[model samples]
Target: MQLKEFSFICPVIESAVVLKAIETVTSPDAIAQTLGNTDSVEERKRKLPSQLVVCLIIAMSLWSSDSMGTVLKNLVNGLSRQWTKLGQYWKVPNSLSISAARQRVGCRVMSQLFERVVRPLATEETPGAFLGELRVYYSYR
Candidate 1:
């Protein structure tokens, strides 16, 4: 609350968008191939496809919270460009829809995708990353 205290605080700025980082780490095409979750089935008429759902799940993991709906809305706001490019206006799916979509993708597929995509985000020099002689990695999610 004091001017001297304020002067000691440095302004932090984010130089990257999370969606861009996600795209660099993994792509929808890759997820589709991994899960066989292509949009080939025209009869389902699902607004939320398996690929997008997979990304949403990953995004949810990144921006973790007690509420899935909150995570999804945040994902939508963060990755608005990707959704807008799909030729349809995107809206955050309801809890039921999210559940259904997740079920449609199946837990097995998600597990596999997570194994394939998730990686250690810390460098060897990061604090407390190693205990004794063993190398350690931390997962934020």
Candidate 2:
């Protein structure tokens, strides 16, 4: 309405490409391992498996503006990658189902996944991360 109210918003990039990047960073095996570590592995296949739920959580960050149902639909529908079942699983679950899946997986899986993958991004040679010749200790607390 007003010139002062105008805001610039960044456009979303291709969904498949972003999903592939996420797959690269968080491989299937790594996800399964984290699930196992958290004792959250599913006993049998379901509408939404544990692994997909894990990925769904990551995808949620990328599609933060969209609803969970829409996000999951985009995530499942955009899997052009050859490794996945793709076309066979186009039937996206409803929001309540997704919520239940999220509940079943619980928070421990994500916490364990974070503990598994997240590490120091800086090496010993980085400028500000280290002192002149010694490593600097940075604590969050």
**Using TM-score as the measure, which candidate wins?**
2
The TM-score of candidate 1 is 0.61
lDDT, candidate 2, 40-109, per-residue tens: 9889878788888988998998788999988888877765453355456468778889999999999999
Q: lDDT of each prediction vs. the true structure?
A: 0.63, 0.77
Superposition error at 140 for model 2 (Å) = 18
Clashes of each: 0, 0
lDDT of 1 by residue, 7-96 (tens): 213343121345656666676656766776433322565667666777778776656644778766665566647543443566777899
Worst lDDT 10-window in candidate 1: 1-10
Q: Distance from true position, residue 83, model 1, in Å?
A: 6.1
Off by over 4 Å in 2: 1-13, 80-83, 86-89, 122-141
In candidate 1, the residue pairs with backbone N, CA or C atoms under 3 Å apart (3 or more residues apart, or in different chains) clash, namely none
Predict model 2's lDDT versus the native: 0.77
Residue 10's C-alpha lDDT in candidate 1?
A: 37
Off by over 4 Å in 1: 1-16, 37-43, 80-88, 119-133, 139-141
